[model samples]
Target: MKKTFDLVFFLLLFALVTACSPTKFATEMAIDALTGAGSSTAFTGESDPELAAQSLPFALKMYEALLVDHPDHPALLSAAGEGFVSYANAFCQLPASMESSWEKQRHMLQRAASLYLRGRDYALRALETRHDGCIRLLNEKRYDEALENCSKEDVSDLYWAAAGWFGAISAEGFNMRRMAEAPTAYALLVRALSLDEGFNYGALHELAIAVLPALPEAMRYRPNVAPADDPVRTWEADYYHGLGIDPISDPYRAAYHHFERSLKLGEEGLVSPFVAYAEAVCVPQQDYEGFRAMLEKGLAVDMETRPDSRLVNTLQAEKARWLLAHAEDFFVVIPDEQSEE
Candidate 1:
């Protein structure tokens, strides 16, 4: 009788434990599987851009569904946020920019902005998991205080959030609310850079190069030019000094510094830095020659060499070609041999 009672007790205890926590165990297992190395490789390793774009929405939705079960899962939140940002850029924003019809372009850009904000929210939530009151601080406009909570481990969240925010700002035109929030996004990016300047091979620098040019003048760094022979002066020092502006800043100097840094970090493997510098820097200056040279350089990058980044490289190459073809639309003065003669 005693032996039988002991066995019954053990069985009852095991059943109670399993019945009470099975859902938790299952959710944990799903999260682990979703975040495993093989999961990301399956997507990044895909060679076909169209196929990847078609399938990505489903994958993003699946991530959202998983987040429903694991609301505070930082990895899931970050992955989902990054997915939305990537989808918005590759599918919506790029296509919109190339759309010929004004109405279609505007509509697509609006949709892209909405998607970017969704991604930004998810990334912010992920940051909240790591630093509980950071979101509250951000809302209160205490941006620096909120960012202080972040550490090196939070760099990915910071980067994705800032990227999405900037994308939304650019996509939505001059919407006051987003424009107001630009400082917060800038703070997030700057904090991420401080924590890890080399993260993702200077992705932060690339982003800075693209967005700094568009920021409001008040938000820019406009320190007085340092002495010509200052031993501690960096490259930006020389650039600003050459511009011959005292107590003034050419936003382009900041953009160019990062442009150079990104190229050095990305080297030959990445194509976007070239395209970004061309569009953001050269086009504005109407330097058609510089623009053509940069796009051609980007086009020459062989995507097959970096199989993991093939999709991005392929997309950027397409953009470079399109920009080259549309060069007439961007420049007011296109020099020809006849004109030179």
Candidate 2:
């Protein structure tokens, strides 16, 4: 009788334990379901930046809530990190760029910086979770292992980590503390470039293009300039620097090449590359015709077919429109094409 009674008691205990466990387990499962569903909806609704801007906060909260219970979930970490980056880029940094008030601009920029740092930290956390001791490896300058340890599949994490780091550095502007992090960001993206040059339709190349041209002469490491007998060898010179032969390296050409490669990789449906090429390369070079052609290329993209890219293209197209409107500010008139002769 005691043996039978003990068996019944243990069975009841087992049932009690499982029944109690299901509440937390089921809640977590529900959170996971909600997160995936919300993310899918957000991706589908990509046409309006304002709508994205409005919805991101809620999505971020959902990610954070999930993270509280499931801190090491790679998907959650990535979503949180990318969410912060998208928010800062679309809402914070863009507006901050336009705030002419010194004090207000400074305030806006600082907020953007905070968001970038948060994103960077979250992305780093995701990496650390993926690879044990990764943070220590990175800090110790064990870049070989840090870069090699991650497989090709981890490209998004690497890219976003670099993006967030660079975003923070850019927002800091001249602040020496954050500016020092640029090389770290550069290394991260370089690793991503090595893993997949075609990642995100050449977004990796776009990022490197932005950084390469803006590198301070001191920070830029380049090979010795080739002899003048071989002008073609000039192309062999590192774009960021050229052994001081030119005093300042001309990275713009190389940057432009990346933009072209990006467009080719993108094939169609992406307009940001065109806008970026015009603003960062053509306009600065005073190539009015090239600038106009690039913007027209951006405007020509059909946003509906590429709905997933619509929001970014919309924002980029607006910039292209603004640049066209202010064309006179960037270029000088040559009177007539034949007059140049």
Candidate 3:
């Protein structure tokens, strides 16, 4: 709940872990590795994104191999769930977000939908591991009922689950069944937002920027997502959030500073901030050159120099390329036709 990945708590937690068996030792190791800045789950340092991307398969298999023996290990479940979400984010969704061709984009979205759902399942496992019977209740469509059993400590896993669910629903396109599932995901996210807007340094807000706006325009600001009572904090939340208000109508005075803060807070070299600003603000305002410049800046970030999020940077840079190529799709150009005759 306090976040910052309290190393002390885990140290004490696993101190009692005798690790009498190899399985137990392995699980303990996985937890430790996750906390490491260089681990696949950690995504920190100047590690090569390509190398990191390549290593993920083995890393996931590492988790799965352990899960076979310790199905209910909370740390393992949390790491694995978060890992899957990151994988989908950096892999499946990146291409989907960038694909200019509708048919290809649809195919990619379908693929992304499955990975996101798998991530959601793992998140649910983590949640249920933490809060008994929560997943079972969730399976029966009792989301709020299930969430009632959660506390502030549950925010990370809740964000993971709802993020995956919402992303899957978003990529899968509009349908009655998917629409029906939205409220549950909505409730989970709102709760997570309330509990920890600082989770991963407003990473949840990155999701919120997309999630809140994806709803019908009229319903964007439901009671659940109302600004906090404290005006300053509410304003701060809105700014760091990727979209940062109506980019179309409002110039978003603090948008640049907001993104700068977001990058400083969590993603220094990550491509997400660049891509987020490009799509959320640039496209809406029809600032083609600005969008291109933002993307170019993201591309220029050296993975070897400041590899905060290599896979994400690489993937999002790819997105920037696609957007540049498809610039006309998002902005209109007035044909300089003359015929004054």
Candidate 4:
């Protein structure tokens, strides 16, 4: 199936090149052929990380090249958006996290942020194509106005745009301008969730575990600041109302709720929920045992059981193993041998 699709794609490309000028029908056919279901499944379902890492750059560049001709092509735009985010996460951000060299890590994170924003722009452009003036409203900070017209069909664009935007913000770390835009990403995700809570096997919920926890940092909440003077508090009061949780007293509750939902929806076939929960929830709460247990569960996952998710599952498992190996770096107190006995 994959070979047949590739052959057809190249034939289309050959036609486009050999002709005096590329016809619209040929270009459209090429776009569809390149971004077809077979291509997506073949790449995603591969188990080899090294192969994926090496191949993804080429694939991503191809998507970009194709986009120059077909700017408004939905499939190409979605592929670009989703591919860049996955590439940044699995290749850039994850590697940066594991790096010991501060300068190298910083450089890698910056690269990740750039890629994430690029992905976000592609996804947002796709959304704009679907709903004109939405991006303009978003830029003007009229989030509610921007998202008002978004419906269920827009969930993929919404999710990828928000994911890439949020990923960029997280990678950049505490830039006030980017931090200010966090609410916009949150609004996008919230809208996506409202439209389809079950999108991508509860991926919306998995993302909430990270995004909700970062609200405090994103808002720049200072413990010394008075409630009346604190923008973070006010923002939380307004935003948290819809999510059904108090950020001031317990910001992690919503994250936990989402974590449970994600785990249930994803089932034992997936490793991401465990890994996300451990890093996002356990580390902050200083639940060392919980952290260890979660990583163990992730590591124990059989990749063969879900061949389509093998690539992602492997990456998540690698992260889980790394976290466990570096557990001492996060925790101040270690239990002695006698205590364990």
Candidate 5:
């Protein structure tokens, strides 16, 4: 009887160990699928976004399957949410050329928005697992309630929650349902600043500069400050002007500051900031030379800091291809008289 019991116990222990091993494999598979793991081997050094994008759906499916077994895994939840958003943005929304039909663009945008909303929800779930009540209040658009829940010790949570709400609100069109939330979006951002001034790496300074200057005359009223001492109007001038905005009303200045900061930060292999800077600030200002310079610098730094940085490699190569394809469009010709002068 003792011998028989020992054999049964060993069998059960082996079964448990085997089952546990698959969970790690599933987790790794989920990450690999999201990040284009083996795809990096194909090009010797760099991965292709097109190929990476193709792998995303399969990876996402793997993540979903894994979630069935490990439902509350933080890493899995965050990865799944981000993967959905990235796949939607990269494959669906970003490929529309000017020649593409309007219906296609509309469909893509809507899909992207939905994916972003999913990401937002998942990120919220991750927060909720930690018992963060601020996220719940923010989701309900109860800004004051959310603010009241915030403490100085956990200000980062407050900032991110407000940012998440802003992102969700911005994803919608001018529907009557969303219209009421517009003012609240701006207010929430302000509240985030009040709670944590360093939110967005202080990119809010640029955001404020960009937004305040473009406000319609009537909408520019300083409800947040005294009539004689409105801080928003002055902030619009100071930060924007410092960033090289001519007439101090240009939104592009805000972009310039943020992009510059991104490039500086990308020294450690953060590429999104550099790419965003190029797209939002440099391209809009017709600063092709500056854009090209920044991208080259970004690529060099990224390579040095993280030679295996797959996303950085892909984005840099794509940007180079873009510059090559649209060389003429990016260049401006000066008149002969102006050139001579």
Candidate 6:
């Protein structure tokens, strides 16, 4: 009888320990169909752009269900926000088809802007999970409250969130509704720079390079504008120094700086930066060689650091298609008769 009681007690204790173990829970979750391993399988298919594009809405729905269970999950919120932004920009609003119809392009661009704003809202909610209320305040257009909430600790998310907000404003134009939100966006970006100068691997520097020089004199009161001589001098100085020269009136300096930084980061096996650099910087500048170099480097790096980086592979395939389509324009011919003459 004593031996049986001892055995029963040991069995119960073992069962309790196993039930509470985090590793066990994680392993179980990893295989769970609803919220675990199956989700990873979905992500694995993202290597194909067409498949990824098709799967995005499904993936987002899965995330939404997970969020219902784990309502405040930061990763889920970030994924959802980023998905909307990407889908809107990459598929809906691409300006390449503008040659066919400007009206269609304009409508698509408006849709992209709406999606970006939605992304901003979701990102703001994610920030709230970390107790950084700046995101919420920024959305509310309470600049002073937002600035007060912002601190050095929140720099990473703050940088990205502010960039998204500002990009939306820039792309869509600042009406009264957006104008109310502009100050908070400006203050948050300023705080991001103050906290971490190297945030986004100096992508902010490129933004400054692009916007400051061409900043309309009238819009200086809006976010991200400053006197050319402001003491904090981050964006301007980094832009000039990164490019090794100043093109006072040229937006191309920003493009050059961003592309260079992307190349530098991608060589270190950071693939997304390379893709972004190619799309946002190189293509905009019509720097076909630069774009090709960045894309090739991205593919090489993706094979190492992020082997499953679907976006990198997509960018590489796109680059190949682009090169094939524009081979004639990309190659220069020197006629023998002209050379002799």
Report the Cα lDDT for residue 302, model 4.
76
Candidate 4: global Cα-lDDT?
Answer: 0.80
| Model 6 quality (TM-score) | 0.58
lDDT of candidate 3 at residue 194, scale 0 to 100: 60
lDDT by residue for model 2 over 134-210, one digit each (tens)?
76776664555666667777788788888888888888899886776665576677677666778877888777666
The reply for model 5, stretches above 4 Å from the true place, is: 1-46, 68-71, 97-99, 144-254, 268-275, 282-305, 316-341
Q: What is the lDDT of residue 39 in candidate 4?
A: 65
Model 2, global lDDT: 0.69
lDDT of each: 0.77, 0.69, 0.65, 0.80, 0.50, 0.54
- lDDT tens readout by residue for model 3, 160-235: 8888888888788876677677766766776676666677756765665555434542232223343453232343
For all the candidates, what are their Cα RMSDs to the real structure? 9.4, 10.5, 8.0, 4.2, 9.5, 10.1
lDDT (C-alpha) at residue 142 in model 5: 52
Model 2 TM-score on a 0 to 1 scale: 0.77
Question: Which stretches in model 4 have alpha-carbon errors above 4 Å?
Answer: 12-25, 217-248, 337-339
Top-scoring candidate (lDDT): 4
Which model is ahead, 5 or 6, in terms of TM-score? Answer: 6
Clashes of each: 0, 0, 0, 0, 0, 0
lDDT of 5 at 148: 47
lDDT of 5 by residue, 64-177 (tens): 766676776666666566556555545654553221477877676677667656665654555455555756665564545555444443433333333443444444555555
Report the error of model 6 at residue 49, Å.
0.9
| Per-residue alpha-carbon lDDT of candidate 6 for residues 45-145, written as tens digits (9 for 90 to 100) | 25566666675665456456456556677666666665565565555544322225767766776776777777666666676777666555655544445
Model 6 residue 26 distance off true place after TM-score fit, in angstroms: 12
TM-score per candidate: 0.83, 0.77, 0.70, 0.87, 0.56, 0.58
Q: What is the number of residue pairs that collide in model 4?
A: 0
lDDT of 1 by residue, 91-198 (tens): 899889889999999999999999999999999999999888988987765655687656889998899999999999999997987787876787677778767777
Candidate 1's C-alpha runs over 4 A off are: 1-26, 219-248, 337-341
Q: For model 4, how does the per-residue alpha-carbon lDDT over 268-322 read when each residue is reduced to its tens digit?
A: 6788888988888888888898888888988887777677788889888888988
